[model samples]
Target: MTMDGGRALVLGGGGVAGIAWEAGLVAGLAGRGVDLAAADVFVGTSAGSVVGAFLAHGGDLEQAIEIMSARPDGDPAARPPKPDMDLVMTAFALMYDTTLEPREARARIGRMARETPTDGRGAALEEIGRRLPSPKWPDRHLLVTGVDADDGSFVVWDRDGDASLEAAVRASCSVPCVFPTVEIGGRHYMDGGVHSMTNADLVEGASTVVVLEPLAHFTPRDRLERELKTLGDARTVVVGPDQAAIDAFGVDVLSMRLWGPGFRAGLAQAPAVAAQVQEVWAGA
Candidate 1:
């Protein structure tokens, strides 16, 4: 791939495992003198948004790797208390009362919802956000993607936008039912992966783009293919885990077992493509 000038880096949504993979790939590229964080623009979806936020605000690869690989679930102090099942059941019962006044039911349900504790997702995102940029920290051209739940429209958050970097990243990382939907400007939003896995399409005007895709290696999707095709039409290179890496880390997104393999795979894969990446960057 040959480029004219500007470079964009796109990070796709995987999960916990995806995070490890992306971290590895970025670090690997950096080792080979291809610093993805130095790109003119950055586009992140789900897990990508987590890593992207860090890189966008002058964070380093080692920091990203350390934070992303940490086992947050294992720490009791870090984990949020579980929701009261009794309160959840009461809310469910309230839903079945056909004759109950709408106002009363709504009030009751809202109260129960308030009483119910968050499952630590908010806290986790907060902790991760702490390591990344705050609102408009450096004015980088960072774009975070999310999907509006109300109408299924794709959302992109830029640094100059009103939404804080944390809010946008939270919205972008919020998986449908697993994590709470984030509300920004009165609209509910969820994971950007619902619309595009890596969001390579966002790199439209960049002369060259590098896509770090964690899911496309095993879980193929037509949407992803179309996005890649669009990037290919311009000048783009896609990197994903090879078969050995896949074998080392299974397809379980939530499993922490893949972190090491993913990281190593990234380092290993970088050398092979370093020259090609340089050529693409140089438009040789």
Candidate 2:
């Protein structure tokens, strides 16, 4: 499907620290005089959706950084549970075990996805979503992605859809096992990152697409490559965490301790990609 407008901005999911990184990227881009909020369409999955919402509504960049950068344990408004260490370890084990058949591995992952209690990290997201513009800016189009927990189907919530923006973003950011699956309009929804961390393909007809991905290294290569291939002639620019940035942010997506480093990493990485982004946008 094609985006209504010629340009699209895509955001990829990353956990707590990821928010900081993306915000930093936003700030860095702003400093470079690159304003991404002008994009015609926005596609966001998981943590990406949170930032996308802010951009869609014209929220303050520094304010978003401050809010997302808060340590969950220390934030009075948040009651996030500690990282589910067992789930993390088990997930890694399942991913590395080549002995299991694809079907069996999928089954195990499905089970693991639902077994953990909702750790309450989502409360902040819900709060943020609620505080965003209710009707949203009419000129902008937003697409928030999520996955249906029961049927394992991919879901895309558009700004014009019946679902409230809050519900859509909440479901999109609901990382399986870390946050509870959201039930909206009879469907149980969870993180769309399970399917594609950056659903860039959704805006197939756009003339240009800018993808800001925090977990680019971890995303399946085939999936991202295929999505880019599907974009056909659209000019696509991607900026993601390099090795140094990834090291600074830490690989633990659920951790909240390294937001400062994550933000700094994004700031450091921005200049290298700024020219590419400027060229694409100018050409678009």
Find the candidate with the highest TM-score and give its number: 2
Each model's lDDT comes to 0.69, 0.75
TM-score for every candidate vs. truth?
0.76, 0.86
Query: What is the RMSD, in Å, between candidate 2 and the native fold over all Cα?
Result: 3.2
C-alpha lDDT of residue 1 in model 2: 60
Candidate 1, superposed: residue stretches over 4 Å from native: 1-5, 68-118, 133-137, 229-233, 256-261
lDDT per residue as tens, model 1, 1-284: 22345888889887666776777777787888887888888888998987787777877756566655675667632443444445544654553466876345544554444334456656655555565645553567788998776655678988667788888888887655445667899977767876667878777667788887887765456656777676655577777777766766674554445556667776677787778777776561
Number of the top lDDT candidate: 2
The TM-score that candidate 1 achieves is 0.76
Lowest summed lDDT across 10 adjacent residues in model 1 is found at 76-85
